[model samples]
Target: MKKDVRGMLKDFTDGLAAISETNKANVNAFMRLLNTGYKEGALSTKTKELMSVAIGVYNRCEYCIVYHVYKSLEAGATREEIMEAAMVAVGFGGGPSMAYSATLLKDSIDEFENDFK
Candidate 1:
């Protein structure tokens, strides 16, 4: 079935909040760490998002791909930059990365771009 990536993400996040309510402190801490790591530092946020897109492709995580692609766009990463990052993942992860780079990464980019429009 074709998934609405943005809707799926919203549902997942809402469910995650419900499940993590009992451990809110831990969840909040983890979120803080993620925020800190993704913030501009030595690397710009766009660079970090590109790196994340590569990692997401290497790992073949659909959720990761969707999330990071959306973030990469938000951080001003061009489609060319995202594709280059996916190619780097292919270098490291071989055939599997190639498959994801061609399919998942491309789909995520299209999905997110459509969502934003």
Candidate 2:
């Protein structure tokens, strides 16, 4: 994996974050809402992990993709569930991003394959 994602993203991600922080409170509010939802059981941890994987893939966030795959596995999601999340992601992001997300999750996916049964 590449050590630096700041380049591929061209600081675009950071710029978006910066813009969000300056423009309004939406980003933090959304994060707080999600946190509350997760803590209140309105959103299950597994579902959140799957959603994270989807977002990571769609956004072409390689590190996030890999981390979330492991997170889903740790949260007790099945292999099929993880793959389905990936499918849903690629459905939005197209082939290149899908391929990248899969590559990002490869080792962890292999490590957790048996847990999916």
Candidate 3:
């Protein structure tokens, strides 16, 4: 079935918050790690988010795809740049990554691209 990228993001956000209530310490640490990882460092946040998109596709994680696509856009990654990252994943992940890149990734881009504008 086709996934609702926006709804997936909302659910993920809500779920993360709920999970944090039950597992505060670990969740907080993970959140901190994410914050630190995404900060502008050796690479720009946009580059990191793009790399995340490729990793998500290669790993076939739906939530990761949606989340990182939204972040990639928020970090100022163009659709072309996102696609290029996904293609690099396809190079390593083969058919599976291509499938996701064409479907879920495309759908995510369609759903969230305008939100950043």
- By TM-score, the candidates rank as 3, 1, 2
Give the candidates in order of lDDT, highest first: 3, 1, 2
- lDDT by residue for model 3 (1-117), tens: 788888999999999999999999999999999999999999999999999999999999999999999999999999999999999999999999999999999999999999899
Q: Whose lDDT is greatest here?
A: 3
How good is model 2 by TM-score? Answer: 0.61
lDDT of 2 at 65: 70
Count clashing pairs, candidate 2: 0
> Model 2 misses residue 59 by how many Å?
0.8
**In model 3, which runs have C-alpha deviations exceeding 4 angstroms?**
none
- How high is each candidate's TM-score? 0.87, 0.61, 0.98
RMSD of each: 1.8, 6.3, 0.7
Q: Candidate 1 at residue 56, lDDT?
A: 88
The whole-model lDDT of each prediction reads 0.85, 0.70, 0.96
Q: Give lDDT for model 3.
A: 0.96
Q: Which of candidates 1 and 2 is the stronger one according to lDDT?
A: 1
Clashes of each: 0, 0, 0
On the 0 to 100 scale, the lDDT of residue 80 in model 2 is 79
